[model samples]
Target chain A: MSSVCLSMEGGSAASTPAALPYYVAFSQLLGLTLVAMTGAWLGLYRGGIAWESDLQFNAHPLCMVIGLVFLQGDALLVYRVFRNEAKRTTKVLHGLLHVFALVIALVGLVAVFDYHRKKGYADLYSLHSWCGILVFGLYFVQWLVGFSFFLFPGAPFSLRSRYRPQHIFFGATIFLLSVGTALLGLKEALLFNLGDKYSAFEPEGVLANVLGLLLACFGGAVLYILTRADWKRPSQAEEQALSMDFKTLTEGDSPGSQ
Target chain B: MSSVCLSMEGGSAASTPAALPYYVAFSQLLGLTLVAMTGAWLGLYRGGIAWESDLQFNAHPLCMVIGLVFLQGDALLVYRVFRNEAKRTTKVLHGLLHVFALVIALVGLVAVFDYHRKKGYADLYSLHSWCGILVFGLYFVQWLVGFSFFLFPGAPFSLRSRYRPQHIFFGATIFLLSVGTALLGLKEALLFNLGDKYSAFEPEGVLANVLGLLLACFGGAVLYILTRADWKRPSQAEEQALSMDFKTLTEGDSPGSQ
Candidate 1:
């Protein structure tokens, strides 16, 4: 996978321009705003933030929008954004962002579970709950594997090479699943509030639905940026910089060194 | 985009195998089965296939599932499945399949509109309707662009090359949006039938929810197959064969040709 990244980096040097980074930054800003707006709609307009009541349910959307949609997108872009930096530093930042996303997501889950328990609502009964739990579980496992294999002491080169593709593939799959789950959860909330007679012409219903559309758009944009071959980080000079860092780190770890 | 495909094909020669095709086939089978099952649950069990009154509403899910889920997926896979075949042939098949999908989706839309008219329900008043209409509209434009640029006399090579990546990106994006719309529609259907008091413990509700989950799984699997870089078709020999065909066709098209 690193080879793929490196090759893309090499391929991008002549084709990409300084303007791309600005476009990416703009996309990030737009995506984050949409996510935050969705959360605000749910939390503020819909009475989701009140304590010790059904309002506690609002925390779920707020945290998830922040963690899964916004932070997760930023994490995916870290390598591209910091292309000139040392590879190790980018990787570490990527891992840390994922960790933060996980923490926030967990809190989101707790908010929903607490709401359910307090209201005596049956937990894990809807398709949304099932998907939410499954995505979270898989995310946790993915994080552990990623951290152990790609960070810290790390795996041997051969093993890392083999696992890298799978890691990226799963990472992308998890992100889409998160977005899908959020849409499902949004649908559930809207249906619950508006009942079967819900109409898009209604202000609140329209807001919720538009929010869902925005989430889908955000996911699509993030995926496009991450997956486009031409948008890959440039590699020519970065290779030299990364190798120098690697050599220094190795020399420091050598037994006879000091 | 063709260059990217060609390069991956060259890279995949050593890595991909005959067995990889089997996996793709299996994914197709599983995805189609899940889509069909979801339709069955709606059409057969939920009175979707009934001829009169609200029962006619059943046509919506059935047609949408067949068109958006099954045919749309097949259209996306045409280039990969027919990699060894001429590019022109694959492009035609891809365009035709999308046309068929659009026609069926239009029928599905009509069914819902007719049902609304008969039942005195407002048309295009739900998020599901909004999403469904938007996806269908974009799909139509995408098909037109793809057909004009890639098939028929076709655009100039430079233009085709430029549009290719956007075509693929939008195609995948539209497909994902279709799945998202379907899930939302399914949620609406379930909530209406099961009422706001729905508990996941109910057998029918569970079935509906599981069907939605199955749809998500199918979408995820199809996307994985489509996006994985290593799974790209081999290009070296195919390029030679395509160029030969192009030469013969161009020669045949010359004005002085007997």
Candidate 2:
């Protein structure tokens, strides 16, 4: 086996695998699928909003069906990738990502179903369009990151690889941004749907103000995550080993090459 | 090496360990964390208008500090566990989670430092008091989940093991209810904080309406994650195996034992 494969199989290496990062990236994308399902649910529950009428879709029923479908697919994928695995650390990581995917899909299902049942408003889409954008954007970002990995042979940031670190750094940046956007979008969608009932419950509007502040904070968190983490540049020797073909390169060529 | 260790060494076990369920449980908690953080950020920006003022605190500053500390600790743990090794799978998982932690921390930092830079808002907590509630509630939720893990060795679907999943189920339900109540409280907060800005932005009450809908979705998402992602209770035999010490318990006692 190649050293990279050996490292992965032996559990003696320091880095996580490519499949794992893609797994996380994909997990984040599940949030988008939730938005889609939620939107569909809201439409159906409200008996199909006037605005969405022209879209040739029934909201509530479609939401339930599609949401369930997405949930199953996402959950199954996560299970296939993470469950019943061994190798303490790796299993833990993959398992966590799997859970995240399942959670997001579940949330999306609820959001859509509840909206459909409550029919709380006329146009769920007008105000909540941002949520859809967030979900779609997140998935797109993950796809890009996952697709990028196929271009490279081994993991990033290894003594034998230079691009690995950069890939990680950029990939993370994309994920955080996507998350922030999703949160913002979700808030906007909710507010648009139920602002009137909210006023009657609280004469002062304290809740709206507080939620707005929270959105700002979440946005800040996204920014913080972006700036603090970076791909560490490789040392000179490490860089060279990463450049040469493994077949032609001597093991001694790089002193720190593990 | 112990046979138990060997069985789990390559991380190839077909059955999930107790830790697996907790990891899955953590995912649900983390989803709530995301929602809470999002709400907290919005509250800090708009003030604690979305929910109860009693829940308010300096969400931005406190979050920044706590988030950073956690990120640091998490990163160190990851590095210690995975760094300098040469495992593809390990490396990928480590890198992704590390990035996730860092990105979230960074977003918090940005919100904190940028408080003074914003145009409309004069002070940090000027947004609303209810936002404090969101931060408070979210942190409390996070603490509750983490402590539950400490209290219960098994999570998600465990019938026994100190902390019953029922208690967790109730706690999560209560948290979701609190979010709904907070949403109903946000109307006045949005009216006062947004004022003319609210009017200027919309088709007569569009902004508030949108905010309401988004809050509804947020609440909906919370409910979904708590209820849906929870693992189903294992079969009697499976549960028995799960409860027993894998190493000490002989397979002869249970016909179905793996």
Candidate 3:
């Protein structure tokens, strides 16, 4: 996925000024990662977070790394938006969504680690799952908005001039995978009644299941809306842009030609 | 949803040549319902498939009605495509999918009705569930392919556009609902597995549950690919045609203007 995003960036270099800010967005993501890791460590080690052997607390390192990678990619996108010499308002706003995704990921991961180690399935686990759900939620939106732009460029408000639907798909797949992963984990926590191991956490687990399903449905609807919104626009600007790109599209036989 | 589709059709009429066929598609769907209903009655009566009770069979007429409505809508879409003066090949192809959906729904209704009457899991019941699964699978694809086109009239082709990330979610929801509905019927067939009034069908029910999940995932993936294909070419073609719509786009702030 990262490779696809990079290649897309590479391809867009000579297209238009709109592509520049995405580079900065990627850089901003890197910086956010560093900040998040430091924050997580401080919260875990120094902030009186109790440790438990049963808990995969050490997974924090891996989570931090993953979080940072995503952040780095996102920050660069942000940089491309605001700091870059040639950038569009749409790209800038879209790039900042990466920051939203980072925050959600950070909080969700920490909550999961903390709640899991605590061996509790009440408020804490609920919080953890909710955070994870939100993370996936935000990431899904990011894909619908920004990534769609990248895949279908000639459309009104897409990301860039490239026709890499694969990148957008990967981003969406990751978001779904992330949601599924969290659901599986939550299912485990529910069946085990992790927070309430002594008794049946059936109620809680069921609640979580329902919530997860609801979240997925709501998120899916939002995505559909976003897709519609992305397409529904019939902008003169986009028409002008398409006209400009028609020569390249004809020569390229690319999917973005339309 | 019909109203939504109509509004969407109205949104695209001036700018797109492909919009006309959906009206035809809807007409085809309406015709299919009569055929489907005939098939359902024939499958039920000629095959000695009487309902266990009139109340049970009569209860969900509303579901049938709802199904018919969608079928009708789909038929109109098909007709519009075929009858429209400015027809695109893709539009006609899309209309054909309605037939697939119509067949599945009819087969499924028969299976459900017979199982309810026999009060046991039957070969027909299993087929129905599988058939329903197939229909849902197609819906996933249709939405994935047609969704963005409806939503973003002039957007580019992204994986997200072709494949709804939320489809996994709504797909899962619909699957679970279908499973639950099946189980409720199966439980009747099994006599709650309390005393094995119908021990013979237990294994079949269990297998259906397992197979349903697997197929839902696999079928969804395959259908998604179909959506991707449908979206790719048109998005590119639309990109090429975008310049021609510039003046209209500017005049009407069609959703794409955003």
Candidate 4:
């Protein structure tokens, strides 16, 4: 691991040491609070949850808010939060967290489909459903590509360098898409349940609005931390050094090596 | 302009000379296509727009999609698109495009509010409306702050540098928020107008869904251009050189100067 090399070379000097932990902690709090708020919205306002009744629909939102938005976001933050950990350790944890999020999200998806089937309602008809499927599909593909390229045995050195930027870009884009999809779902859910009361600032409507804002805020917070160049894992300087090595490696090698 | 200095110093060497144009062109086409699609959806399916009647509400989504999502996104791309242009020129154009977007978006806002008020319906109650207002409010603030810091004779160089990253971060976040809000609006609008037929795959619903996907695709394209480190203006090497200048400028001076 590059991090292993960094530690061996006394390259563990992380910048802004004092600020990052607070950021990580704040993100954790917001994520957790969002999950809890989603649960409360479904339980208190939408009736209690159960698999056999129409209330099973509640699990769709609860599980998605926790698994997709909250857990998935926290998984993305793992690399930065555990900046000093072994790169391999973080990579494995990253993959594992994604796995956990995906499985929970799968449960959420199944809950909705099973509920819809019992009621004989349409499936994957609304824009929310379409976008939801899109987000999940893309996230899965991204996870697979990331696992193959960066985790398992790893792609060739040059291949990894070329793909890293794209991997990061798609990861961030998929996260945004997931958040947007979740917001769409929230709006549809509120409208379906509250009907005209949604136009009158009903308690359920108000609660859902607050939840949407929290999700947006949580999303913004995570992206800010992720984009802050100086806060990059292994420090920015070491990152450049590593990339510079990448430059040299590519410049010296041929396509045959890959 | 830093770019003026760069030109004086022979530092105008943009990387990815051929690919950058295609990227910019593709982004422009996507943005234009998205705006046109919104226009078609409103015109054909929403029964055309008018100054009065419920039809006026059509302008809300149309203008928001055009101004907030498409135009605003293109505005953000100006810097990277014209990487070789004068920084001051590009900065003014950037501010102006934002102004243009805000004005068009204001027209959209007024249309919806006036429609709601005429119908005796509540305003800003729905999650879409709430998020829409938030996106617009943040965009206004972001534009104002960007103008004060980067234009209007500029902040102190040190202060400018300090705020630039935040400006860029918040700008991207707001853009994303606008896209999310647009998707929410599209979903609600389709549901409201198409009603139960939406679940039956109405043409309008499908059109709106396609439009939402285009918006997401456009956002991703613009952000990809924005985030690619190698595609940065003044070239990455020159950017580092400029930042190194800032480094000396900050380290050599007192905070009192700023």
Among all candidates shown, the one with the greatest lDDT: 4
lDDT of 3 by residue, A1-258 (tens): 011111122222333344234433443444444445434533543243333443344344334334523442343333223332333444445455555656646654675557554865333222223334554565656556554564334443243534335444445444434434333343333333333331343444334444334323332332333233222222334444445556545565465524
- Candidate 4: regions farther than 4 A off: A1-12, A235-258, B1-16, B235-258
What ordering of candidates by TM-score runs from best to worst? 1, 4, 3, 2
Which order, best to worst by DockQ?
A: 1, 4, 2, 3
For all candidates in order, the CA lDDT equals: 0.76, 0.37, 0.39, 0.81
Please list, in the order the candidates appear, how each scores on TM-score for chain B only.
0.86, 0.37, 0.31, 0.86
Q: Per-residue lDDT for B154-173 in model 4, tens only?
A: 25777877888899999999
Give residue A81's error in model 1 in angstroms: 1.1
Score candidate 4 by DockQ.
0.37
TM-score of each: 0.89, 0.31, 0.34, 0.88
Pairs in steric clash, model 4: none
Task: Report DockQ per prediction, comma-separated.
Answer: 0.38, 0.05, 0.04, 0.37
- C-alpha lDDT of residue A71 in model 4: 81
Residue range B83-190, candidate 1, lDDT tens digits: 666566776788889989999998888888889889888777677777888899899999888887766452455666677778988999899889888888887887
Docking class of 4: acceptable
lDDT of 1 by residue, A1-258 (tens): 112433433334534555567768776877877877876787666865765777888888888888887788778888777776667788889999998999999988899889888888889878888888998999899999998776745245556668877888788888888888888888888878787447636777778878877888778878888877766656564576546545654765532212
